[model samples]
Target chain A: MRDGEPLVRWAWIGDHVDELAHYTGVHLRLGLLPVLLGLLISIPLGILCHRWRWAYPPTLTAANILYSIPSLALFMIFVRYTGLTERTVMIPLTLYTLSVLIPNVVDGLAAVPDPVRQAATAMGFSTVRRVVQVELPIAVPVVVAGVRVAAVSSISLVAVGQLIGQGGLGYYITRGLQLDFPTPIITATVLIMLLALVTDALLVLAQRLLTPWARGKGAAA
Target chain B: MNGFLNQLSLVGDWLTSSQQWHGPDGIPHRLLEHLTYSGLSLLFAALIGLSLGLLVGHTGRGAFAVASVANLARAVPTFGLVVLVVTLAGLSTAPVLVALTALAVPPILINTFEGIRGVDPDARDAARGMGMTGWEVLLKAEVPMALPLILLGLRVAAIQVVATATVAAYPGLGGLGRFIVDGLARNDYELVIGGSAVVVLLALVVQAVFTALRRVVVSPGLRAPASGP
Candidate 1:
């Protein structure tokens, strides 16, 4: 009877949606916090380099070098110090995000027509105001694209965190494999794909929501 | 880091053990027995994928069906699917090869079909007007233009095989993944890092080799369009 419990998977998803939501929310927070941190750090870094030409290649190099560190190896490095808490997950994942996010953000900002910035400056817009009103708004779509990539990568990386015993859906996959329960393993695996799809869809919707100007441009075009 | 230096030395040390390399382990002899498993599977898949894609493109009506099948297969996580295959097929190199090849076929199939579909219509018309047979037109006109996209599919398959060939470790054929899994078990970070480094290096090397081959085989005009818009 007790053995049957393992096979008796329920529609607990309905009653337990909140708990699942919490799990996904934490995982997203874990994944996105670093992305958020990375964006905060690297976008400004990217902007500065974009504003000043010399910092581009070297800043870009730092991100590339960081990216080549494979996710599992990175998780190991984090484990050596932090012993597999959220910090361990965030640090390497954040570092990884800088590579993907910075280049896009910088590219988007650079894609801003030179005339627009010059015209903003000529209009006596303060440097900060020019960047705020002119640059970020124009670069929003590309930055959002970068955010999409980071979101996907980080959600996938959440599985690695489960390797160290974190309790996301990855825990279900890893734990089931260990115990020889394919049901849980398959369920968890499907859950992960679902989670990733949901994250991607949310990001897409968020991009549309945040960039009303894109819709306006689409309409006019 | 010192850790990095230590790994380089270990690789250097292992390279010296010829027996292990040729036979099993402790050597860097590039064992053919294990290498052929992945190679043959990829070869088999590419052959099937190309044939199916060609049939679909020439037929055209069944494309939506093929696309749905490829999408469904590709959606399965390589790790989970491999595990499922192994459980069903019994633990051995067979399941690993099947899983990798199945995983490989979709990309190649999709690319080849799209590539053939994208062959310029005017070019096809001109070839026909020039007194070419249907087969002659396809061979001389369509395949030549589609070669780069076909090669790109093969390249993706090659990289995927290189990475996924590691997953064969669980079934006991002992690719780079064996080192990673063992390293994880032993808490030897160096082994995991070293193993991954090798896999990454292998992938990069394969990519470079294919890229160079693409330059040699693909015609200049076709190459540019086949590669990008």
Candidate 2:
């Protein structure tokens, strides 16, 4: 707006480097941990559903209903029980991940071909070993795609936690709006987008590494 | 135990008060503001997104490009965009409309595109064989067939916009979210919870209305398979 003051001021970030780092750390945790927790819960639950046909339909329906709940309502409702602590934020964030992840986990397991299961069985693989060694590995790409969506969505939702005073980059957003400053708002938005892209790329890398068979054998010159 | 009871009573009192329903500060007014913001944003988003999506789907070109942009847009936080717009444009309804519109666009666009793309090729061929023009085939044949998924997209977009538009109150604007933002600042947990209850109720009602409408609008033959979880 001024001669030297751009919408996003690099100098302001330089001046508040320590606070920026802290906020960035908070943002990363708020974004990443919930999705990780969801994945942890989903893998076993998804496997059980895959093993037992009866569980899949009900579980899928429940997840969809849960997904429909507004994130703000979910975040705020927990305040009564959890107080203003980080758990209030983490619990809903973690639970929300289940709605998106469970469906994806089930879809991933479903993507596994029937012949692959029979092949593993014929090879004398036990149920647990076959699932771990064969089905789960083949399911990684589909599951990872879901993970990417969950991760990105969680990151966006985490910003909403600022209303409760727990948001990381969200602090800058609220603070900026309150002060009517353009710099922090612009900077945080850019950083959050970059964070999403980085997280997506990392997940893609994880998918590639986990499923080496899916990759082309070293390309030649 | 006592604190929870007090909160409940507080919320009860707030909801029961005739004063809360009377002025611009009233729940009714705030609800009106919230719906107006969400509704207008949805309309604008649907107009732009549906048209582009229809063109992309019917032409079968730029599908990859649209998908890439939609996926990228998914990562952009609504709060960040709202704040950025407010700072640039100053505090007004503009920020809320712009931010919620951004939120509503991708799903509608993606769904409309997919709905059109997913129309049975045989049906498209049959329409062509019947000597229909491209416009006639698209309007009569494809659009009708794709209506269910397109409606599904609109339902998703509308619910999301309604929920998120509450944040408009955070920037000193009036919406149901005003209760939460103001209450939190003043340590009025009851007001916060009361506001959230209304938001949750609104969300569920919107979902139910859409679900019911889907049953009415979608051909009964299409309903069975389109019942996506």
Candidate 3:
């Protein structure tokens, strides 16, 4: 940002359109993959915690400790094993999601009304079937609420991976800083924020579609 | 397995070496810088977030707006904010501080508002029944009742700030993150690992301090049952 240079050079964006699109794809991959993986891991872990109340406190404490470690630090720590690759970034991000996802999953399951559970049990549904078909469906709204938070945070955090040479849009931010230019920095920042918001909106829409019954009852979680 | 142990020992050696502890660029000075950045950002964030949260929560107004704004804030990337601020303003600690404070505010504000809002109506009524005014009721009854949540919010904010202030080093500002950023540039894995280890430790210490603070500050009667064995 020099005295005479414009804050954002429109011409630069025009030239970097392909590059921007490439990074957007990379950014989405870096950000969303961990969330997908985390959801897979959290569901079972959440079920376990919900089933055995004793498991929750320790699980939650471990997740909180993992969550508190900064993204950069975690990235560096993982680099020891994973090298300077996408795995280094995704592994930490996946661990980070547990803190948010596990709680939400457990809460979503817990929100199932007792009578609803009893009714499911009475209807000749097997234990596994009842949990899968009845309980989980009821839990969709709450689970999706957690997913929305996890997705947005994961997306934003993906940019910090740039410090370790893997951040999606974060690359441009650091590049812009090193080059003493503002256009890429502003552009990347806007895109990352846009990506987060858009992902969040999509999750909310998905929640609505998944739990049509919950539509007019106010926001999830 | 061997490589992992080797790296661990490397990190241990880096930590134990006395030379790493003595200079202006050493661990002690960097730790101090890290703490200063974290403390200052937390102070500003607490001031702004706490005051606004208290006002909104006590009045039972603007809860929705505060929550939406806080959630939106959470979506902003700390790295982007740091570079954007530094690129807009010149390279100085000011930009770093601004970014760090922005990162920390949302958690504190939302938690405080939620805490105060969650206070029992019966408690408020009892305070009024005791002839306390609005401010007195808020201070004496609502705040004390909300202390746990408010403290939780502060703890969250403190940990976040401690973590993010590391990014302050990206703009050539000094802190523990200086090691990670500079270490990567120099291909110094030892420095990177050691710096990251210290940061994780610091964050844990902050978490522990807050947990202990909660036990001391929050009255036993007001403390939630789940917090106890």
Candidate 4:
């Protein structure tokens, strides 16, 4: 948008390939590590809520409240304790994931038909074993659905971390803005979108491979 | 624990200072700007998303297109879009509004489509059997039934817009985000903390308002019993 400046200069991209690649890698890690950590935390917590019943409402309320906080505000709040480290960014992102992941995990588990659960019990399988080996498999499609949403959202949000100086691809976006340039902004945005879409597609594929039996159930729920 | 209390007090002091309350950049003025940006964007998003969702959901045609667009929209980063648009259009409120509306649309559209599409077939058929036209069935039977989810969609969109409207400040627009962004630039941690607290409070108030609206607007008969997540 500056005079004589093309929307994107391929020569600039070619020159900055190494820099772009580094940011891309950082972007993936910043965007995804929290999702992976969230899954670890959410699965057990979701199961607890599912089994106890009483815990779900308060737990959901807490997560929803946390989710409502803006990403930048959450980042700044955490900066008080976490300093300027990546932890500041990841902490809020992980918390945000809980609102999406827990419900999906619960719903996925609840989707297990009573008769199927009865059969699992009648077959003398222990509760833990039934949950892990029998129930979790049935829950994959639904949980994956939540994961897909969380992953894309997390990836997109990682850029907002730039305000605190931790934004991955977001750095280029801000840089482009400050310098009144469009190439980096456009390039970074495209890459972030691609990362989200690719990650979502991979999750869909993983769901298919994991739940071949659900082929008859039609496209993802 | 002491440090936490210290920070809280700092934020409180910042919030209460008389100097912070009166001027062009005052809290009240910025808060109004934030609300205006959020309100305008939400209105536009609702108009576009609701109408498109109704058309696609009613006919069952273009469902795939709607789903794909929603999914793709989810992947687009709000910050990136804002910066990208600003860089292209130069600094102005219009680009920011465009970006915020774009960010808010997918949820409303998807939820509206799904809510309508998910209406019980029996109810739809019953409406038709009673000599209702296509429009009548959609309006009388389908939309009323889908009211809860449609309201839910609006609520989600509203909250999201209010939060992202903070980023609209990055393009030199005035809003609550001015405090955070300016605070960061000037290394005023107290101001940053105070500003973030206000934004969080505003979001909560918005959430509460939507919850109250849902209670009033959604029919009690259609309301599902309070259930665990």
Best by TM-score: 4
In model 4, where do residues sit more than 4 Å from their true spots?
Answer: A216-219, B225-229
TM-score of each: 0.69, 0.90, 0.96, 0.97
Better of 1 and 4 by DockQ: 4
**lDDT, candidate 2, A1-221, per-residue tens:** 23545677678988987898888899999889888888899899889887886887678656655666677776778888887776777788787777667767777788889999999999999999998999988888878888888888888878888888888898989888777777888878878888888998888888888888888864110
**lDDT head-to-head 1 vs 4, winner:** 4
Q: What is the TM-score of chain A alone in each candidate?
A: 0.85, 0.91, 0.97, 0.97
Report model 3's TM-score to 2 decimal places.
Answer: 0.96
Local error of candidate 4 at B124, Å?
0.6
Docking quality level of the chain pair in candidate 3: medium
Top-DockQ candidate index: 4
Model 3, which residues run further than 4 Å from truth? Answer: A219-221, B225-229
Q: Model 3, range A66-102, lDDT digits (tens) per residue? A: 8889889999988988888999999999998888899
Q: What docking class should model 2 receive?
A: medium
**Which lDDT tens digits does candidate 3 get at residues B68-169?**
998898789888888888888988887789889888888889989999999989989999999999999999999999998888788878877887788768
Give candidate 1 regions above 4 Å deviation.
A1-168, A210-221, B1-3, B10-23, B27-34, B55-75, B128-137, B168-173, B222-229
lDDT of 1 by residue, A82-147 (tens): 775878778887887787687777778988899999999999999999988999888878887787
The positional error of residue B210 in candidate 4, measured at the CA in angstroms, is: 1.5
CAPRI quality band, candidate 4: medium
Quick one: ranking by TM-score, best first? 4, 3, 2, 1
For residues B100-150, could you state the per-residue lDDT of candidate 2 as single tens digits?
Answer: 998899989998999999999999999999999999999989998898989
DockQ of 1: 0.17
- Chain B, per-candidate TM-score: 0.86, 0.92, 0.94, 0.95
